[model samples]
Target chain A: MATPVYSGAARTPQRGRPRDASRDDALRQAALEVMAEVGYRALTMDAVAARARAGKATIYRRWESKLDLVIDTCTQLAQQNLTEPDTGSLAGDLREFLSAFAAFLSGPIGKAAQALVGELPHEPELASAFRETFLTAQRGVLRRILERAEERGELRQDAPRGMAVEIAGAALIYRLMLTGDPLDLPFVDRVVDQVLVPLVAKGQ
Target chain B: MATPVYSGAARTPQRGRPRDASRDDALRQAALEVMAEVGYRALTMDAVAARARAGKATIYRRWESKLDLVIDTCTQLAQQNLTEPDTGSLAGDLREFLSAFAAFLSGPIGKAAQALVGELPHEPELASAFRETFLTAQRGVLRRILERAEERGELRQDAPRGMAVEIAGAALIYRLMLTGDPLDLPFVDRVVDQVLVPLVAKGQ
Candidate 1:
């Protein structure tokens, strides 16, 4: 059997004074930095420890393995600007979501997210953690936004909000991953105006 | 420098007893099979040669490196279906394109494609070749279909065909790569009928 390369539950929780929470933040940030700089394949626990100015024990105290640390860092990075906007209109809310989502993709988190996706098939646990922590959270935000829109009678009666969320977010990610293009304001504008607004508009 | 793994350019141009092209085909198929079984990181050229019952010289003669062989094989596997229907309308054409595209993603190429994307960052040359061969070809297909739609007055005159194509294909790829979903027919139908067609239709 292929050995388990990573697992979140493998870490033994510390019983003493809670370790420096600040160090946790620094380590997570360091993980993202190293991943972006060297790619996921080259990232190592030692590198993350050195970059964060923390001992290897500190990292191990929190994450069971490098994959665990990477997943946590990705989760934290994705959550940085995940607040949902309530502009009272589906267009406004979706525009904000897409804009923030685009910024995240083009920002540090984007690099980490791409690296994580690249690592998924090789590391099944990392893949599962990524879905639960990052993708599922982001999808939740989009679902809530769409649910509000649907309640307001903004979407077609037969429209699937979950699929809508998938389409919107997937469109942006596809560009980032496959095209290797910068996510610009104009592209965001086009996605919102052309795709989101019309799909959610009451009448066809 | 890393030792080259493939041998596509080394063979002499001989007329008598042309090298068995069938052996080359067998090796490529075997490579993909091993990749699906053990993944890209653990795959070996010797294993491929053994699987094909061909000498290592035969394998190296056709590909200069493992990356080269893998990329060529992926291109061959991916090139199976590129047909786009006229259908007399943009929606119909897009629906057809997406359906066929989904089929490829769920088929043999899908697993190899995922493996390749996972391996790209570790191998930039392979990534570049993948983009040039597979991604560029697929994008061209979508572009041609969209361009024809615009010419037929089905798409908005001001609509960005490039962005539209990106969104359509990206949405599908994103779900496949991140969500691990099946990219089912109903999802494709909803995206085509709800998200794509209305977005590209003329007039707000």
Candidate 2:
């Protein structure tokens, strides 16, 4: 079993009180706009504060650093936009998951992720938390969906092969991060049918 | 078909005589050392020149910017390390290719790539050339190997599915770039046997 390395060192908590919902919304929207405009390297907390019309102290109370702010903005976006659909079968469950996944990748959070990715290697805390806070949350959704389909006997006994489970997600990430390609509905369908469906479906 | 978009904008060739082989080797090696030491963002052309004991002109004459130099060093490393294996079976060929791929990812060039990936989206010219110069070259090798497998009846005629052709490479990349997981031979073997072999083998 590949032990999940959920390192806690990365998620350095904010020093002040928890963020209010509307304030949080304004700050994150500002973060995304700044990220898209300036790219990650040039993106600064001051600029985000300026853009959002929030005081610098308000931004700091929520996030410790620019890296934290960006990561939080993305995390908030994921929680807001992400949902798992139960379509009664493994294929449909996955199609629903991927459709939502593709849309997420095309939206604001996805753009933030792309911009922030280059900094991941240099920032250990950000990298670890990103996997746990963001990527793991998404994977957990997929895992539950797969488990349900298996219970219904719609999938192979050895379905959701450990690392192979990542093929769809990994391929999608590869297209976005490395290859600089677009992710769309048709691309999602092909991965599900050609790769995931063929590999995991029962009595194929 | 995805048209090959090879814009000449990124690779602004130097207006100079051909670089000497030994000097080029020293500069590239120095680039790797500086990258490993300071990472991509901090790496500078002046630093590379100082480290390699070469003039700043020598470095600039060869590369337009630090991004160009880094990409070129990675490209050269890929050409040097990349090789095709006639392993006679799709499984064997994939195994051989992945082993080499794993080894490369664990090496100096791999380290450089890890360091540079975060900057891809911000650097359009570098991103485009990276797809063309580094990634496309590797994929071509895999494609030829797969085509041979299909010809020998070892694979389904449409064996290497369109997007799924990326599963192996993408999985490996996702592990490295996103998840911060190690890409070892055993990891490589599981993806081949479980995900890839099952997905494409004839009579599955």
Candidate 3:
């Protein structure tokens, strides 16, 4: 039930001592490592500071609380991993973007993220950051692919857009988190071909 | 990553006394309550025993570890809630089953379960129990409905059986855990109607 402090917006930059980008990067990486090791509930600002080799006051100056630090760090990490891959076709574009996403989830940030994702509902700010910085970004990539497909006459005008955006990612996550299934290239291909292509692609 | 100790097996009954059914029930309920309060990684046997008003030794004698106790408690709770409802059509059967599941997730056991689900990958035994006791059981119900539909010629013979079974639940979980979206009756209806019905229903 802890209120999560989000990283973006509403912060007037302090006048004295401009922020150090490298030190901030170090702290974000440290926060991820600490969260991966200890999980969300046990994560403390002191632990992140110690891990990052920065003074506690330094961390506090940037982030109002531990949740803020975590949200900021994770948001940065997700943004860093996400790139919209355009392959000219919706199927190819989806596979590229989602495959990139699946790879990220299999990496350090994603591993750390799993520990915190379960707790998103308790903290409104955290959930918002997760959606805005991560989930929405991923969905936005999918949405763009669909729109382009429509322009090229590759997608039907009435393909259930909401359901189209959701099913592939939903099924992939279920396989990853719930079933512990292998998320390889071939698996991604199947999701696109079988589920996604069937759902939306024109003249398939 | 700690290997989770599962509850159903590998317990050699301690020589002194057979476990009383009522005492066992009390312990499981107490374990659930404690987990609902503290979450999975922080849950301890001492807390469960204290909550149950039983000696720590009694709990230890039966279950090997806290993970074992939690798995047992959650599995029992899931089983208690899982009853195959036959509503003649796949859509009705899915709606009824998933609705019941959504209700359980909104309750005490489900609330506590959200905290533990994230840790499943770290613990092999815990993941197995989850897949076996809860997830597989739920899937099994869906499979039966699908099979029955096929038998009645209500389903296409070439419908991707695996994807058909997976999409609805996956979308629901995506909404519940990832999107933090409301899993209300209407949302469930869309998942069933928009996604699921299109996936398998004949003549779509």
**Order of candidates by lDDT, top first?**
2, 3, 1
The TM-score that candidate 3 achieves is 0.86
The DockQ scores of all candidates, in the order shown, are: 0.45, 0.61, 0.53
Give one digit per residue, the lDDT tens place, for model 2 in A1-204.
Answer: 122222222444645566487987898899898887766668888899999998998888777887777777777676666666777877887887787778878776666777676667766876876777778776787787778877898777777555546786797888778886678888888888888877777887
- Interface RMSD, Å, model 2: 1.5
Error of 1 at B84 (Å): 3.6
- For A1-204, candidate 1 gives per-residue lDDT tens digits of 112112323223554667676778888889888987776767999999999888998788788788778877766555555566778888888878788779888876776667777767666777787787677777777777788887898887766667667878787777677766778778788877767666666774
Ranking by TM-score: 2, 3, 1
B58-123: candidate 3 lDDT, tens digit per residue: 899878788678767776666667567777888887888778777777666666776667666555
Candidates 2 and 3 compared: the better one by DockQ is: 2
| Per-residue lDDT of B80 in model 3 | 68
- For model 3, the superposed segments whose C-alpha errors exceed 4 Å read A1-18, A122-125, B1-23, B58-62
Clash totals in order: 9, 1, 0
